[model samples]
Target: MQRAQRNSLRLLQWMMAASLALPVALFVIAATISYTSTNDIADREIERTLDVAHEHALKVFETIDRSLAELNEVVRNLSDDTIRAREPALHRRLKRLTDSLPQLKSAWIFDADGKALVNSLASPPPALSFTDRDYFYSHIDQSIGTFIGMPLTPRPPYQGARFFSVSRRRDSDDGNFIGVIQASVLPEYFESFYARIGSDPGSFFAMGRADGAVLAHFPRLNHDLRLDPGGPVGQQIAGQPERGLMTIAWPSDGIERRIGYRRIAEYPIYVSAGLETSAIRARWFATMGQHLVFGIPATALLFLLLAFAFRRTQHLQAEAAARREAEDALKHSQRLEALGQLTGGVAHDFNNLLTVIRASVDLLNRPQLTEERRQRYITAIADAVARAAKLTSQLLAFARRQTLKPEVFDVGQRMQSLHDMLATLLGPAIEIVTRLSAEPCLVNADAGQFETALINMATNARDAMQGKGRVIFEVETATTIPDTPAPVSGNQGFVRVTVRDTGIGIPAARLGRIFEPFFTTKQVGHGTGLGLSQVFGFARQSGGEVTVTSEVGQGSTFSLYLPRVPPDLRSQRLAPNTAPAVAGSGMSVLVVEDNIELANFAADGLTELGYNITLVDNATDALAELIVDANRFDVVLSDVVMPGMTGLDLAQAVRDRGIGVPVVLTTGYSQALSQDGAAGFDLVQKPYSIEELSRVLHRAARLRRVRDGAAE
Candidate 1:
């Protein structure tokens, strides 16, 4: 009986052991298979990502090569003309073309001695000497198809922005190198779109020379690429095949990563895309987590199953949650980066503007400064202020908060008036083509806003062209009626003004949101991103609309439509252009103001303009003076606001007295300019330029002349 009982116990123990061992063994096999399969998928994903990167990179190279080839052809054609380099038309054409390639900083024709002759940038680039440059010397030393220079800053007068240039040898009939046609490009342009190229965040995207020197790298470590002995992108791929992948530890950051690099065919360069090792393993680990859960039932009978699998199950869930967090993190990071860039750009540009203002101010304060030099500094100050004001105007316009006084005007005529000024705005690199209609395209809009909008569009067009291209300003009449299938902006007679560019077109992905405020395709500081927003606001506010149509590699067109009015509509005459500041001719001027400082300032300015000045602190005081000697003053000038009665009241009182002196009210901002007591009187904005003040006073004086039957 004892022997039989012992046999039963032994058999039970064996069965229990088999049950646990068999299930655990199966679980291990399944886990291994799952991990292997997942890794294979991860490998394929890497390959797809790499190919996408490669294709995108190839497109960039193709664009540059095609552009260069087109330029080369241009040179070949110009070879027959000996003085082509000196031709203004040819220079203009070259400049326009170079500006079109926004990446290119400047385009130039250099003589055999490497003297820069005609440049696409405005007449003869400042500090045009280039013989010292290696790119120039390289062609001089030997013939090369297109030699690219290392990043460099040219010299003084050209501010310190790092640039690289591509040069093609211009040869004589005897095969001796003559002048070269060169285009300088900012290296940042090549790397600017790297983040959008489907490469992983924090991974390196690099363009390298055949000799394993880095040309450009995203997340720029240096304005120029540098060589590091501890290779992240260089030596590891020096002798690699035309295409291959290698893993290395990134020197800048301690992350181990795998890189896929391709040698650019037909060029002595290589491009690479990298991926972090930890990121790769995340997918593999996730696969194991899934297997652990799936294989749990297979080993349920095994009480002693491996502890590590359970830990990973928890880890995998946590990683998934962390991944969700990471996505949010990515979005936050991008926003921060954009904000940082925005602020950085704003500071950079403002600093440069401020530097000019500061230097001008300093020069103005110098005791021994020549009158001519003082005038120059003053002019510089004025220019800087105008530029700053324009910047402010854009901000206000974008916010739709600026006070605008609309007027009836001919759109075609307005564009014509602005033609010369717009040319200066676009520089010599761009062609301003105006197609003004013979028939007047009449519209009622604020002249200031109208000009600003036009400038904004033209500037945008200039940017779209990368600095060079044809910008067309066209004005035509259209009729928009409510309930029409194809309405011309809607329910009114419309005058359409289109600003079109023949430059790089907008991408389809970005087209929809181009009108959004603070959204831009421009590098930080280069644009406020408010330009189009201002256009949108101006159009909508003006009882019309603006529209844009674009395609990649083609160009862009922005059409601004405004409601049209009859030709018979009496247009408000723009303040006529004053022919320089004229002597006041001893014209007696009555100056009234609430502030003592402003009154004195006005007196000084008027006195300098050759006017006899009677300064009063307030309208009440001014009125007392007027009663004492009404006809003694030739014109009445007063500040709009005062402690007693306002300038408007004073003007009305002067009229009540039968005084015929024309009153001009000056204010920075006042609703009273157009209010009850001030109707039909001339108005001048405060902070007026001396020229502006002179012009307004002369107009007032002319008004007196006209009323007296002498005619204004």
Candidate 2:
């Protein structure tokens, strides 16, 4: 009997191992599979990214190549000053080219002895030397095709300046080396273009020569052009494959990178899109994290299930059954609580958003609305829609693709605009106080986000005071980091905003977690716990920081720090929104949207603007329309989120098929878009007005022209 009992126990133990560890092992395998699959997908994405970088690089190279070809044509028109009347036309053309392509720094002609004949520079050089230049030496045979040269820093009036020139060898009728037409490109343009590519933090995209000269990189701000082709980067890419993926560490900052590199077929250059291994690993682990949450519990449950199934021998037994049950119950309770919290937030915020939108709609329907009042109503409606979309996006945890539109704005003016809005939002019980800077605090930030941050701070203050105490809002200028007990910077100035509330102050320990998501001191159902988190994130993302101070009984002060740009150096990017809209004038528009109401809205909008519309349900249909007769449409306007295929896929399809129609993608909130973001296609965020749409369409048409003209 004793031997039989021992055999049964051993059998049960093996059964338990098979039940529990099998699932666990399967989970590990599944996770590994997921990681590998995700990596492959990421590599595919890297290919798209490489293509984009390649396109941007090609724009410059093609521009220079085309300019050289045209310069040759103009020289043919010249014929040794007998047709010198065309000289003025040639200079005008070069100037126009410079204007059209910002990257084309200067275009000039040289004599046989390497003396300047004509220059596109504002202050033209009377004479210039190319005797020592590679572009000159390489083209000594006076070849026709374009020749690229190593970067050079010329001396004199343009001192300490560096540029790369693409030159075409000009020759005599006898095929003797005469001179060259060179178009110098400012490398800074690469940095500018790269910045606009909008790669994530710590990720970099670069365009360089196959020999590994880094033309430009992002977050590499305001530095003199640096070029070293013989460096490590050069050694890795120089004379490398036409396309490849490699692991490398840049000497500038020794961060390991998985680089996706492709050599441009049109030019002797390569483009690299690098994502750090840490980021990739983070994404992989995050996927595994989700699986583990469900996988471990399921595995343990299997163990319990197997034990219960084989109860006859009393063979299988759960050692920590009680403990595990409690843990499972706790996890279940936590998940329910989280679900309830999320649902409540969605319900409450949606109600508020709906109320705002409904009110705006009612106002917009006013019969006797003045033009000014009509504009205000329209603006209000757009704002409400944007707010509603943002709230919904937050519920879905979708990231926003649109960046902060930082511009110089007077804080005093903004405060005046907010006064009435705050008064209404905070209600009657809270006493409002504004202590603004006397010398008009000018700040650089997304005006809308800044306003939202202020309102959030005010809302928190009102809540803390239980709607019955004073809430003080102050804006001041500071030359140091705010409230940091330690020195963090070397006198970097900030436009500081402080929100002080007279309320039940926070405890010493709990103060540390105030900004954490879903952490709130308020009673259940009263708070979504994301208010302060938004403010904190916005501040940090705007190249600033936030700090807080509280005494148990003395109330709390939340201070937000935003970097201050010097008045003289502030970017002049704030264009007036009064540009006259161009009527479509029977121009054909293709509308691709899944939402019937949104499609109708777009169709009606274009119709009002005097355009013909062809509506499609999804990307597939849109592609079909384009494939059938792409020239039938001037622009394709599509919603991002659709059933069959997304707007991004459609835009990509349009490009892939080599269709020449300009595509405009519009979106409210899409997780896919928030992550991968808009490809080179123009993106007009939801809640845009007819005027905004017009502007983007105009811009898109211009871009299409530039792209097609380049192709030709």
lDDT of each: 0.73, 0.74
Tens digits of per-residue lDDT, candidate 1, 1-712, equal: 3355445445545545666776678767866786677556555655676676567556655665566667556665454344344557657877777677767777777777666656676564453667888778888867877676777776666664577777778776678777777877766776776666646544567776665566677657654455563464556655565877777775555578766778776777677777677766676677667766756665663534434434454466567668878988997997788668556645665687799999999889989889999999999988987776666555555545544567898888889999999999998999888898888788888787888889888988898898898998899887752333343433447888988899899998998778765678899668777678778777766667888889988899888878888788867867565557767999988888878887787778778888898887788888888788778988888888777798888888988888777888887545444223247677775556667788788878876787788543
Q: Give the lDDT of residue 325 in candidate 2.
A: 82
Q: What is residue 601's positional error in candidate 1, in angstroms?
A: 2.5
What would the per-residue lDDT of candidate 2 be over residues 525-631, giving only the tens digit for each residue?
68767777677766765667889899876889988888776656444455555687768878788889888887888778878998788988888988988988888
* TM-score, model 2 to reference: 0.40
lDDT of 2: 0.74
RMSD of every prediction: 48.3, 41.6
In candidate 2, what residue range of length 10 has the lowest lDDT sum? 393-402
